[model samples]
Target: MGWQIAAASAVVVVLAGLTTLALSPLLGRGRPEHGGGPDRDDEILRSTLLVAGVIGVAIAGVAGFLIARRAVAPLGEALARQRRFVADAGHELRTPLTVMHTRAQLIARRMEPQDPALPAMRQLLDDSRVLGEIVDELLASAVLTADPGRGEPIEVRALLDEIARSMAVLAQAREVQISVAGPPGVWVTGSRVALRRALAALVDNALGHTPPGGWVQLAVDVRGEHVVLAVTDSGEGLAGLDPAELTRRFARGPRAADGPGGRRFGLGLALVQEVASAHGGTLTLGPAPTGGARAELVLPIRS
Candidate 1:
C-alpha cells in the first residue's frame, strides 16, 4: 500500500515537471507583460504545481518508509517475546533440576555397594545433571545474546577439571577414559557457566564418538595472548569431514552411526560454536596427531 502511494506520487511529480518544461516557451511568447515579466500565468501555474508535486512526493516517501517499518513492527516484538520466554523458562527450570540432582546424589551416597538400586540412582543423577545443563546452555545463550555479559576470571585448568568431573558418569558408562592434563593457574575472562557448557559439549561429543576402552583427553595451553582448551578423542579422525560443516546445525559426520552413541542429532557442535561466538572465541575442529578428532576452543587471555 505504501509503495503504491509512493509510486503514484513520483509519477505525478514527473508529469508536472514535464508539462511546465514543454509549455514554458509558448506561455512566455503570448500576451502583454505582467509586472516586470511577460504574461506566463499558465507556465507559473505549472511550475508551482511541479514544485508542489516534488515536495508532496518527498513527504510521501518519508511516510512510506515509516509505514513499511510499522508493518513489520509486530515481527520484531514477537522475536523479543520469544527471547524473554526462553530466558524465563531456563530460570524457572534450574532450581527444580538442581534439587533433583542433589537428592539423587544423596540417595546414591547412602546406598551400600551391594545395593540393587545404586546404579539406577547414579544413572538418574547423570541424566538429571545433563538435563539441567541443557537448560543452562539454552538460558545462558539467550541472556548473552541480550547482553554480551560480564566477564569473570575463570581458571582454565579448573574449568577443565570441572568438565572432567561432570562428564565422568557418561565416560565411565561407556568405558572411555577421561583425562585432563593442562598447566594450572591459567585464567581467562568469560561467563563460567557458558564456557563450562561449551567444554562439556566437547567432552560429550568426544565420549560419544570414541569406542569403549578408548580415551578422551582435555588439554589447555597458553599461546601468545590467548588460551586454548583442546578436547581430543580416539575415534575415526573426523572421517575427513569439513570442520566448518561440522559446526553447522544438524550436520552429522559420514560415520555418525559408527560411534558408541550411534547417530547423533548433531546439536552439540553447533551449541559449542554458539558459545564460542558469544564469548568472542573460536571453535576449531581438526584431526588429532595420533588419530580421531580434536576440537579446540580458543579465547583471549584475560586483559
Candidate 2:
C-alpha cells in the first residue's frame, strides 16, 4: 500500500510539469506540443491561454483608438465654431453698415461748404467704407474655409488687365504708374472674386507705399503646370523681417505702420496668402530684381 501511494504522487508531479511546459508556448516564448508528450489536458490549457492573450491585445488596441478620437474631436469642433462666428457677424453687419455709410454721405453733401462738421463727417464715411471692406474680406475668408469648392477657372490676362484698369485712378492719385504684362491666352483655375480681391490688395499696398513716379508692375507667367503672378513695388524694401512671415495673419514688418508709406491695417498680405491657399496655391514675398518688394502668387494648373 505505501509503494502505490508514492507512485501515485510521482505521476501527479510529472503531469503538472508537462502542463506548465505546454502553456509556456502560449506565453509567447516557446514552441507548442514539445517532446511528443501525450497529455490531452496540457493541450487544452495551452489553447485557452492563447485565446485569452489574443483577446487582451485586441481590447487594448480598441481602447487606444477610442482615446485618440476623443482627443481630436474637440479641436475640430472649435475650428468650426470660429469660422461660423466670423461668417455670422459679417453677414449681420453688412446691411446696417451700408445704410450708415449712405446716410453719412447724404448728410455730408447737404452740409454747407464751410460747415464745421463737414470734415469730420467725411472722415467718418471713409472710416465706414474701410470697415465695410474689412468685413467683406472676413466674410469671404470664412466662406472659403467652410466651402473650398467655390473657386472656378478664370482667364489670367483678362483678370489682371481688369484689376490694373480699375486701380489706374488710385495709382494716378498716388502718382504711381501701375502696369500689367502677361501672356494673352494664359488662364488659371481659381475664384475670380477672390483673385480680384488679392490683386487689389497688392496694388493698394504698392500705391500706398510708393513715392510719386515710382512704378508698380504686375506680371503673369504660365510655366509647366503653374500660373505665376507677381506684383512688384518700387519702394523701400521690407526691413528686419524674413519676408516669409508677411504672409502670416496680422504679421507686420519693420516698416510696418510706424514707417512712412505703410498701410494702417496689416491684413493685405494675409488675405493674399489665404486666397492662394484656397485655390491650392502658394504666395511668396521677396526682393524684386527691379529694386523693391515683390509678392508672388503661384497656382497649380488643373491636369
Clashing pairs in 1: none
Worst 10 residues of 1 by lDDT: 256-265
lDDT of 1 at 221: 96
**lDDT tens per residue, model 1, 7-71:** 76776567667756666665556646765433356556666666657766676677677777877
Taken over the whole model, the C-alpha lDDT of each candidate is 0.81, 0.77
**TM-score between candidate 2 and the true structure:** 0.64
Highest-scoring model, lDDT = 1
* TM-score of each candidate structure, all chains considered together: 0.61, 0.64
- Model 1 residue 262 lDDT score: 35
Clashing residue pairs for model 2: none
Model 1 stretches astray by more than 4 angstroms: 1-79, 95-126, 165-182, 207-215, 223-225, 259-265, 289-291
